[model samples]
Target: MAGTIQRHPVSPVSALRLFFVAGWRSNLALFRWMRPSAFIPTLIGVPALQLIFFVHLGRYLDTQPVSYYALGNALHACAMAGLFAPAMSLAGERFAGTLPALLATPANRTLMFAGRTVTAVLVGCSSTVVMLILGSVLTDFRLPAEGIVPISAAILVTAASCSAFGLLVGAAGLRTREAILLGNLVLYLMLLVCGINIPRESLPDGLRLIGEIMPMTHGIAAARQAFTGSGPVTGLLLVELGKGLSFLVLAVLTLRFLERGSRRAASLDEV
Candidate 1:
């Protein structure tokens, strides 16, 4: 029994089972690790920047809307946080050979993915709430007492969307360092094009149209309308909710396709 153990290659279903076990355990590790790394920045730096940019230096800018930027910044932090947290963690696992071992196990892929996605959502929301409380305490931002609920929904939805996309990118580009770079670059472009820092109306007509398609476009606008408005929350809720789910579904499908292809080509453990 001790002689060189010939490992029976795992079937697709067995591999998926292993993946779920590893993914969940990995997610818990992520939960513990990301607190100081990702959460701290989302809690302090990003939200403080929002307060500083709007409250301190916002008036001097040309027609820059503070109320709009507040919630925009919040969405920005959620997006950035999702990108920074789960993707980086996945990359680390890939480097450590955890992913191939995971795929070789017997866990369900859907359960595996759900655990990772849920981790991203929960962590993203926790950090977002800290940002919200910071905004309320440090700035003139006025939100509905019940506003926390919708904002949280938006944050979790957005985080799931981003994390799913990250998983796709991470899996597909495991060999290249471009995954993180590309994600952050896309995030930066989204920040600019999505009318977060500046109104879409201020952009050229063609650019304005492009901005509308970005997830950040709908996410930021919807979040802003909810954060500083005395009006109905239904519209913003619908926009963020619907669009966020769409992005998440698309991203998950991308992950599913990419994972199958990736496994067909090579396992994560192979050089």
Candidate 2:
């Protein structure tokens, strides 16, 4: 009798059902939160300063399509920070004991993570749009309808991968405080090094290798091609596709495993 207990069987989430999980809800909340925050100004603020700075120093590097950099940075603003936002937010949520409450619900851990990742990508993309509008209005930069669909698709996929990477960070924090520090460090570093401000073309050979590992590199490469129409689109899109899916796959397998470990270690509710 002690071992034998009556229990209600729970239903497995259908593929469609997984789409509506807490992760997505959390992602939406992030978007809603952005409205009140200075989302637009925050995104374009530095870049606006950049445009002015460059304009003043006119003869600097007209070689590269500086106009193209504006749109590229829009994608950067959208896809860049995402590599770390999920993990950083998760760390905060775990520390605040919010994760336990969310996990206790029927919403699976992976789904919750997925939703947050999507939210991060959305925020990035939204920020880019804001920047794009501002840049278009203020400057003569123009983006085409042809590039729009591919760029959007690329950003979405990059978001999924970064979300997975974030989960990796969150899980690492479950092990030690050092993980949080490292996670935050790399997150910011990725923002700078992964061809966000400086172009991949400009980075030293060593750092260029590091850039290749970043999801942003692949996505930006595709998006850049989409913007310029100078090179073959297929190859860039293929690279972007591989990186995005690789991250998603890794995030799903790794986070779910880490979720189990975190629960067993009693770290889930600890913060």
The sequence of per-residue lDDT tens digits that candidate 2 reaches over residues 186-243 is 6566656676556778778888888787666777677777777766566766776676
TM-scores for all candidates: the values are 0.75, 0.75
Candidate 2 collision pairs: 23-112, 23-115, 24-115, 78-124, 94-271, 95-271
Error of 1 at 68 (Å): 2.1
How do the residues 182-203 of candidate 1 rate in per-residue lDDT, one tens digit apiece?
Answer: 7777677776688767778889
Question: For model 2, what is the alpha-carbon lDDT of residue 235?
Answer: 74
lDDT of 2: 0.62
Weakest 10 consecutive residues of candidate 2 by summed lDDT:
2-11
Off by over 4 Å in 1: 1-24, 30-43, 146-148, 228-236
TM-score of 2: 0.75
